[model samples]
Target chain A: MSRYLIQFAYDGGSFSGYQIQPNALTVQEELEKKLSILAQRKIEVVGSSRTDAGVHASQQFAHFDCPVPIQKDWVYRLNRMLPHALAVISIEQVADDFHARFDALSRTYHYWIVRKKTPLRRHDTYWFEAPLDLEAMNAACQILFQYIDFECFSKVKTDVFTFDCTIQKAIWTEEGDFLKFTIQANRFLRGMVRAIVGTLLEVGEGKLKPEDLHQIIQSKDRNQAGRAVPAHGLHLVEVKYK
Target chain B: MSRYLIQFAYDGGSFSGYQIQPNALTVQEELEKKLSILAQRKIEVVGSSRTDAGVHASQQFAHFDCPVPIQKDWVYRLNRMLPHALAVISIEQVADDFHARFDALSRTYHYWIVRKKTPLRRHDTYWFEAPLDLEAMNAACQILFQYIDFECFSKVKTDVFTFDCTIQKAIWTEEGDFLKFTIQANRFLRGMVRAIVGTLLEVGEGKLKPEDLHQIIQSKDRNQAGRAVPAHGLHLVEVKYK
Candidate 1:
């Protein structure tokens, strides 16, 4: 059997989520169907991460084992069969032991907020009509990197065993009329990024003090955190593997 | 009667077009309906531009006359009543003679293209899987400013009497993975910007020579020009008036 590592991209708007369901459409289901058709056999794809419904991913990694040897142009052929919103970026032969999910090292996520009232980009970006205090939000974001436990921000009844996540970097930057929060971590809990962004927006809107962020994290109570931000603003930028 | 200039924004994806059609939902229809309900009388709004279906506007200008004075906070009220994708950014009292369409000085458009093969931003930006030659595209863009008659790029069967337009600025710039073209002109014929972008993309892909752009413009034949780029990639960035 030959194992192949596939790098793909998809717009999350049309998907129920990354994982498979009984009748709902998903990125994984579509890809597996296409891969099965190309290989002339049924195939199942294992993804590195299970992104939530309405969450977008730019570069997602997956692995599949095939009975037949794969050709170099499989990437080109798969892309042709896929829809315009989903694309197969690259494909390569992987060692039999190299699993896409198990070998992943880290992941990066970006959340976008449009401060100005723009009709053109409303669907793609979260619009904040009130003036935001970016400096205050950044100050609060600095506290996030210092914490390892994010139980306060995680969704309840999550399958993940531990809430411990080492945040490598968390910073907020403004580009044009958009405020972007880029965060890197070993792994993220369910609804963690959206919860964190919502908390940060509270700081930006002067509802919560910058120093209160640490207190909320220590509270270890989901209710202590602000409301989760909308999913459309969040994007999984990249996943790293070693 | 008092005339008010309203600055609006809308995601054109849900609308048939800006103009009111017999059986189609339009931006104008939505706004007029809301305004008439609020005023307890029939109302009409004259927009500065009638954008095509699926074409978004960030800062669209419109004018409507009201017999009674309106409170400044009506802007906030109108926004709260409108859909998430449509917003009234500002409303101001204007001269009785002010015309949203005829009094316009210049309009700016922005076209977004994503060079990478990624799915996360599919609807937000145009995705071109092929590698683009930016320098060649920019070289061709320079030729756009030198042209006066843009009949070659205008849509066929348009009712506009004159094809003469002075393009004040036309340039392509790359930011991260996005290639954006910003064009400002005194006036634009229907489909002109998309046609120009389509032709310029041909130059970027090495399908057409940069010098051939001038010839395409001089030919004044819509069929000779490249295909009209998709409306989702184009945005009315700003409209200026004096």
Candidate 2:
């Protein structure tokens, strides 16, 4: 059997999520159905990450094994067969032992928030009517670097074993009228980035003190965290593997 | 009566166009309906330009007259009442003789073409799969500045009285994987920018010679031009009046 590593991108607006479910449309199911048809056999794809519904991905990696080698033009042919909102950008042969999800080293995410009200980008970016205090938000973001446990920000009843994650980079930048938060971590718990952004927004809005973030992290309670931000503003920017 | 000039923005994917059409939803109709409800009086808005269906506008201008003066806070209030995809950014009192379309001094347009295949921006930008000769396209763009008449690119059956428009700036810039064409002019005829982009793409693809653009403009026939590019890639960047 030959294993192939596929790099793809998708707009997750119309999908339930990346995982497959009965009676629900998903990115994985769509790709598998097409690949199976092309190969004239059943095929299953293993994704690097399971992004939530309405969350976009700029670069996502996956792996699939086939009994026969595929042509180089299969990448272009698969793209044409898929919907315009999903594309298979590249395909390459990989070692049979390489798995997309288990063999990843780190991942990065970006959350976009438009400070000024813009109708053109309303759907693509989250709109914050009130002015954000960038300095305060940045100060609070510094607290995240000191903590390795993020149980306060993780979603409840998640399948992951532990909430420990080493966050390498968490920085906010302002571009024109948009404020973006880019975070890189060894791994992320479900809904962690959104919860972090929500808490940072509270700091920006003066509802919570910057130092209070430390207390919230120590509390280890989901309720201590701020509300989760909308999914549309979140994007899986990159996935790294060694 | 007081005349007010409003700077607006909208995602044109959902509506038919900017103008009111029978049995079709439009940006004008939506705003008029909301204004009537708010003011308890019938209202009509005259937009700076009637954008075609599926064309987006980042900073469109419009004017409407009301019997009573409006407060500064009306900008935020109107935005709350408008749909999420449409917004009124600024409102200012204007002279009674001022008209949004006729009094405009200049208009700017931006066309986005993604060189790489990206699924996330499929609906937002045009995808050009083949490698583009951007330098050749820029060279062709420079030729556009020498011509004052663009009757060849204008849509047929257009009601404009004159076919002459001063091209102030026409340049193409490459940023990362995206190529953007920005043009500023005193006025534009219908389908003018799209036709220009289409012909330029033909030149970039080696399907048409760069010098043929000047010949096509001199022909002054719509049939002499290439196909009009899709409307989604076109954006009304700015409208200026002095």
Candidate 3:
């Protein structure tokens, strides 16, 4: 069998989620169905990140194994057949043993907080009415460097072997009317990024101090943290591989 | 009765067009429906520009006459009631005789051409695989300066008093991978911008000479010009009023 890896982007507003299910539309199912047609068989794909519903992906990856070598012009042909919400940006052949989910490097996610409301960006941006304190937000980001286990930020019923994740980068950058919160980690728990952003926004909103993040991390209690923000504001920007 | 002029922005992908039609969703109808509820009476608005289906507007205006004074908080209230594809940006009181359509001084339109395809901009941009010579396109833009009767570029069977328009500005600007064609004029005929863009593209494609535009304008034949481009790529950027 030959392993082929693909890098893609999707507007998650169109799908239920990344994983395939019985009744609803999914990114994985659409990709797998398209790939199966191209391969003339039932070809399954393993995604690197299982992003939730309404969470967009600027750069996501997946790997699939096929019995025959993939054709050269498959990228152009596959993109033509894909739905408007999904597209295949690039494709490459990897080692037979390569995996998509269990990769070697970190993943980056970005959450956009738009100050002004525009009709064009209603899908991908979260409109925040209150004035945000960027100084407090960035200050809270520094507190995240001390922790590895983010159990307080994970969903309550998530199935995970370990809550430990190596934090590489976490910062809140101001882009005009848009406040972008970017985080990079070796691995993430379910509902991690949105929860962290929701909690950090408390610091920006004056509800919580910057140092309050330290206590939240040490509590290891999901109830101690703020509620998770809406999924539409989050995007899987990149999944690095070695 | 009081006349009010309101400026708004719309995604335009969700509406059939700017004008009201039977059994079709339109920007004017939606605005009238919401405004009538806010004013507690029947309200009618005259739009400054009649954009075709799938055309966006960053700054479009309308003037309406209402029996009672509009509330101060109606902008916020109407925006909440409006669909995701449209928004009432600003509202203000105007003279009783003020008209939306006839009182406009100039209108600006932009056509976006994308060299690369991204999932987010799929609705608003036109993806062209052809290599365009922008120098030739800009030269054709200069050729438009000497002409007033653009009947060849106007859509056939269009209801218009005259094809003569005062062309104030026309240019193609390159912003990274996106080429924006901006045109400002005192008035525009139905399908004029798209046809002119289509004909100018032929010049960029090396299919037609820049000076050939003179003969096309003189001929005053709709079939003598190139085809009108798709409506999705066009945007009514601004409608100047005095």
What's candidate 1's DockQ score? 0.52
- CAPRI-style quality class for the chain A–B interface of candidate 3: medium
Task: Give me the TM-scores for chain A across all models, comma-separated.
Answer: 0.96, 0.97, 0.98
Better candidate number, 1 or 3, judged by TM-score = 3
Candidate 3 chain A: minimum summed lDDT over ten consecutive residues — where? A114-123
User: Per model, how many backbone clashes are there?
Assistant: 0, 0, 0
List model 2 lDDT by residue over A1-242, tens digit each.
99999898888787888889899889999899988988999999999999988888888899999997798788888988888878888989899999999998899999999876776676568998786788989898889999999999999979988899999999899998899999999889999999999999999999999999999999999999999999989889899998
lDDT of 3 by residue, A78-130 (tens): 88899978888888989888998897498999999888667788889887868
Compared with the true structure, what per-residue lDDT tens digits does model 2 show for residues B116-226?
A: 678767766898878778888889988898899999999998899999999999888998889899999999999999999999999889888888888899999988888
Indicate the residue-level lDDT of A76 in model 1.
82
Question: Taking the tens digit of each residue's C-alpha lDDT, what string does model 1 give over B27-81?
Answer: 9988888777777788899999888888888889999999877877777778777
- Per-residue lDDT, model 3, residue B68, is 89
Stretches of candidate 1 off by over 4 Å are A131-147, A203-219, B38-40, B130-149, B171-176, B199-221
Between candidates 1 and 2, the one scoring higher on DockQ is: 2
Model 3: residue A240 alpha-carbon error in angstroms = 1.7
Candidate 1 clashes between residue pairs 3 or more apart in a chain or in different chains: none
Q: Give lDDT per model, in order.
A: 0.87, 0.89, 0.91
- Retained native contacts per candidate, as fractions? 0.75, 0.78, 0.57
What candidate 3 gets wrong by more than 4 Å, as runs, is none
Q: Output the number of the TM-score-best candidate.
A: 2
B104-223: candidate 3 lDDT, tens digit per residue: 999999999877656777788887758899999999999899999989988888888899999999999999879899999999999999999999889989999999998899999999
